[model samples]
Target: MRFNVWKRLELAAVTVGIAGVVLVGCAAPDEAGVSDARVAESFAAMYTQWLTEPDLTEMDRLVLDEAQRTGRVTQGQYQDAIDRLVSCMADAGYALQLTTYPSGVIEVQPPVAVPDGDDLMSSKHFCEKTTSIYAIMGYEMQQGNPELYADPAVVAFNCLEDADLLASTATVDDVKRFMYSSERDNFPFDSEDFGVKACFYGAGMAYGTVAEAE
Candidate 1:
């Protein structure tokens, strides 16, 4: 599972390194200030939300329980959950591939060459619930957002300001537009960009399993 949260997946649709097109960075000016406790509370609530998910399998409940007790999902726990998801999908006859890009993006390929719109998503969701994407997201969130930005969009806003990639007066909405609007190739969030590369270092992209994944 190449789900390195610091890389491009942080801004992706799932916000968990699942075929995302942007990266996470660090070094925010005072404006992005957010309390660590607030961030942790929001993140905890997010992790808790999954506990009530109807799609969760019995195994998912066990993972969530361990996470609750620990207050953090160890690298091993996160990877184990990913392994379970892959295995579960395979068991269901949907062969899945988790591909890690050199840019540290992780993509879970579709199970089949061509799939029915409804069936493919349904099957993927079923298998996905067996694993906890939150464990990985929590790691990245901790890294790229040590301040624990309760708002995911704000994380990138600070990164943008830190990098001076955009105008100094840019609003969070403007950054949001950059995130949802810009193409990865032309934007500074791309791995090839030096500014974000610096942010990667600040974000501490390496720790335990996350280091190995990258």
Candidate 2:
């Protein structure tokens, strides 16, 4: 019950934050010709892809092993729970979608110009928000449809959240910090470097969640 409530609240917060960011980002850019919608859209679209494609079998093994290690469940029941979850995702039609606000001109000026304004602050802010957003989405999706996920769905939820959030942000280092936080350190996954490879691979897998789980 605690996990259920926590998951729901986190999801609501994420959806609201993402919605607020979309509203704010729709304004005109500062000096750059880019649209805030562009950034927001890109982030949303990419993260959707990450949630859809995972080796549910392998992930099942990992979750059960960790649960065993953490004493949540035994090895024998892990596969059964995973099978139930995969079925749930398939049955639920769990597709990710992006909602948006309209366009408007905001401002064009140098940034707030903090001591380390150019890259560091920009990276951290975007990364932190992105991580929060996906964590929220992951919690929402799996929790809202608990019948669709395996036991210990939180484990997969965290994995998808970590990867999806990092992949959604603006830069590589920030993404790494978001993905490799202490909360996720024991999860046994690698940090994805940014660039076309990370973008396509990381984001590509998320979209694959729409397809039937293997």
Candidate 3:
């Protein structure tokens, strides 16, 4: 099947896992008609692109090549990536912890004392850059979002607009930028409504794990 590879967005940290992770806010080529194949194309392209980069470890290259060949990152592949990343982090002297969410997003929890910026990168970036980064993200795109809105925040903000919950003029980026900058706590939408939750679901983002919690 043909896929319209998405234009990768500069997604800021959605969960504070790693710096500059390629998830949560990746935009598609258009608002609709995008699909899992498209998402896979974007990810697979990255896999190929990384092959051109000299620094990628041979092990990582093997994993990426497999994903590209299959046009998707399977659960086994994603798990392997997580394992590789965790092992790499251990080698770097950081004992990072893994938190698994139902939607296939893994939270790599660095220690509380871990400093931000360069120090953080020095300790953890290689592992993340090489492994599982969006083996997690791309997998979720295929599983969770079929309608494929650019990102959950974009769709949800528009949903809110329909509900009169947001200013008529506010763009998705406008709202997201504000929330990230200041309101993080005081931000307007609660995401409790079923319809709003559906908006995020349709957008490929897990609303509170993207499943009915047991």
The residue-by-residue lDDT of candidate 3 on 1-214, one tens digit each, is 1111111222212312222223334444345422112222255554454445455556556666776776566877667777877788788777866556455645455554555546656656566566655555545444444333344455446556665766455566654543334332334544444544444443433323223322
Query: TM-scores across all candidates?
Result: 0.52, 0.18, 0.52
Stretches of model 3 off by over 4 angstroms after superposition:
1-50, 115-118, 129-175, 185-188, 191-214
lDDT of 2 by residue, 1-214 (tens): 0011101222222422432333323445335333222212333332343334332244443443343334333323433443343334334332212211111111111222235434433543343332223332332333232221111222233334444633343343333333233342323233332221222222211111112123
Off by over 4 Å in 2: 1-72, 94-176, 179-190, 193-214
Residue 193 in model 2: lDDT: 24
Q: Is candidate 2 or candidate 3 better by lDDT?
A: 3
TM-score of predicted model 1? 0.52
lDDT of 3: 0.49
RMSD of each: 9.5, 21.9, 10.2
Candidate 1 at residue 33, lDDT?
Answer: 53
Error of 3 at 80 (Å): 1.6
lDDT agreement with native, every candidate: 0.49, 0.29, 0.49
